[model samples]
Target: MIGRFKAELFLILATVVWGGTFPVISELLSFVDAAYIVGFRFLISAVILFPFLFKGGLFLRIRQGLVDGFILGSLTFSGFYLQTVGLNYTTPARSAFITQLLLIYVLIFQVFAKRKRPTIWNVISTVILFIGAVILVDPFALEGKLNKGDIITGLSAAAFAAYIIRIDHVKSEGRMVSILFSQFVLCSVLGFTLSFVQDAPVPIFNFTSVGFILYLAIPATLFATYTMLKYQPKTTPMRASILYSLEPIFATLITILFLGIWPLKHEVIGGSIVFFAVILSEVSPLLRHTTKPEPKN
Candidate 1:
């Protein structure tokens, strides 16, 4: 089993990589339809994981892998689909802010679905995270009316929260490889189908676009997801969500470094607060410091 601190670190690194992906995808979207890139990304990852089918006792438990992969793939696809669809109706910033609601949805699921109560630190971290997300996204810049896009994106957040909860339950030794392979295959098929159905424009094939796809396939999806599956189950769902919330903050720093785009004042302030929230969650156990009872009293 993975140690808790190591798992948390791996997941945080996964989120950091995930955060840095925005610019790559944003650049690709200029010349490629969303569906095409999504399809290719999963297809490449699926191909890379194909060799794992013959290893890791995968064949012994192939059935379990299939079922769990379908469950996970479907949830992941739904989350992505909802957010993609919602983006058509809402601004990206607004949608991003709404997606952070996953932190709350995970808490609710933990309490209602798993019969686990949130620690006080979880509640505090969540509140701080939400405030930071709102400030970072600056939803006030958008229209005052509640949009359909926000509602759809909110559902996406719930789907992702559910995915997080289910993954911890289903992850097992020797099966993650097969499960990941199956998920990639399923997602590739769905992405291709969605592209066809939407009649998305043909993707431009160039060194830059191909490089972007390879980066996403190899690093963002394959490596990052591998770490997530291998490590996230060792930590609390609340902790995982809180760490993922650091994505926007990482994105801010990445932008400054690579794109030379400086953040707005709100973005900087909000990002700082969000980073602090993750720090608070991480050190919460240390803060409790409960005294031990007298021996043999």
Candidate 2:
């Protein structure tokens, strides 16, 4: 029980760290292109983890890690690339909220790919989540036109969902670090190549930019990924998803701090609804199990 609690707490902290990146990345984007930012961040991370690749027995797992890492890295790079590009076209708050659609995408993937049916509570939570997203985005305010960023952000959510599903399926034991290291290398290579091809502006290495990049590469990328990979398998998927939903809340808070503007009334309401829906999804299962009568021995 204590171990489980610690794992959950670490996962939430990792999510919070991820949430903090939205504002930092948004700020960095002003000075550097998205690909450059992604490239450097992953490059730094891969460098930090490079020594692990040479550990005595680690070579044995390289082949497996390469295959799994390629798949995971592709999904991760796609998600981050889309999210960063989408940031150019939308507010951080909206982008974060839209990305939460990943939870719904996971459900859809399970239904179709795994041939599984969602529980009634799962359906209920999904509906609530949808309504909350609609309120948060408020498409009507845009004259029925979706922002390009929102559409791209939605696609990013799907990619992230696929990533999550793949993680659940792969369950690569004892080689997670190797897998993650390979993923960093792949992302770094992809990011740098894309940056050069797109002719992204070279990032200025001022104190401010360097500080943000260090923060992102160290805490947000390395620490967060390590904790998530280490701890997530210990918890239920629904619980992890619910915890991840908190990222938008943290993102909204950071956004408010950086922008100095309070969220509009609808945003507050919609974000609250989405948060509660996530909580309900996790809670309902516990409620059902507890309410069931014990069978006579």
Candidate 3:
């Protein structure tokens, strides 16, 4: 029980770190191109984790990690690149809501891959979560027209969903550290290459932006990736998706704190609904079993 709780806590912390990145990255985009930001941030993360790639007697594991990590890293890169580019064409709120369609993609993929349909509770929770997301983002204001950026962000969500499923599939492979290190390195290389190809202007170094970049690289990229790779397999992919849906909520709070943006009434209501839906999903199974009558011996 304690172990599961700890694992869930770690997942939550990872999501929180991810959520915190929104404001920082949004700010950084003003001074740096999206590709360069991705490049330097991931390069820093690779540097932080580089030493672990050389641990003794892990050559076989490293080989496997290289292949698996490259596959995973490619998917990750696609998601981030599309989403960041999409951000240029859409509002952050719209981008966030669309990006989170990852949950729906994961659920659909799980149904097909596992050859099992979701439980009633799972389906209900998903619906409720979707409703909350709609409320949070208020897409109705968009008048049913999705721009190019919205479509790209939606595709990014699909890539992210595939990435999540891939992580779950590869959990049996050991050497998580090596795998994640490889992923960071690959993403860094891709980011830098794309930045150069696009001729994105180089980011001018300043204290504030540099600090934000380091924060993103260390806590958001390095620590968050480590915890996610280490602990996410402990939970069902659906549950993990639900947990991650909390990112928007966290992002809202962080935005309020850093930018003095107040949460609107709908955001508060939507965030609460999503939060409780997640809690119910986590606890319902336990409650069901506990309430069952004992069988006569």
Give the best candidate by lDDT: 2
> Model 3: per-residue lDDT, tens digit, 69-119?
899989988888888788777545456655766766777888998776776
Candidate 3 has an lDDT of 0.76
C-alpha lDDT (0 to 100) for residue 87 of candidate 1: 56
Task: Give the TM-scores of the predictions, in the order they appear.
Answer: 0.78, 0.90, 0.80
Candidate 2's residue-wise lDDT over 1-297, tens digit each? 888899999999998888888888888888888888888888899899877767656677676588889899999899998998898888788788888788799899999999888887789888998999888777887889878888889899999999988987776777776788788888889999999998888888898898988888999999998887789989887788688778988898888987765678887888788787778777768767787899999
Model 1 lDDT per residue over 168-284, tens place: 799556677777777777877888899999988888899999998898789898889888767888998767867876776676567567766676687667667766766666566
Better of 1 and 3 by TM-score: 3
Q: Which candidate number maximizes TM-score? A: 2
Error of 2 at 215 (Å): 1.6
Clash pairs for candidate 3:
none
* Model 2 misplaced stretches (Cα beyond 4 Å): 1-9, 230-242, 287-297
Candidate lDDT values, in order: 0.75, 0.85, 0.76
The 10 consecutive residues of candidate 3 with the worst lDDT sum are 90-99
lDDT of 1: 0.75
Q: Which pairs of residues clash in candidate 2, taking residues 3 or more apart in a chain or in different chains?
A: none
List where candidate 1 sits over 4 angstroms from the true fold.
Answer: 1-16, 56-61, 81-100, 145-155, 227-246, 288-297
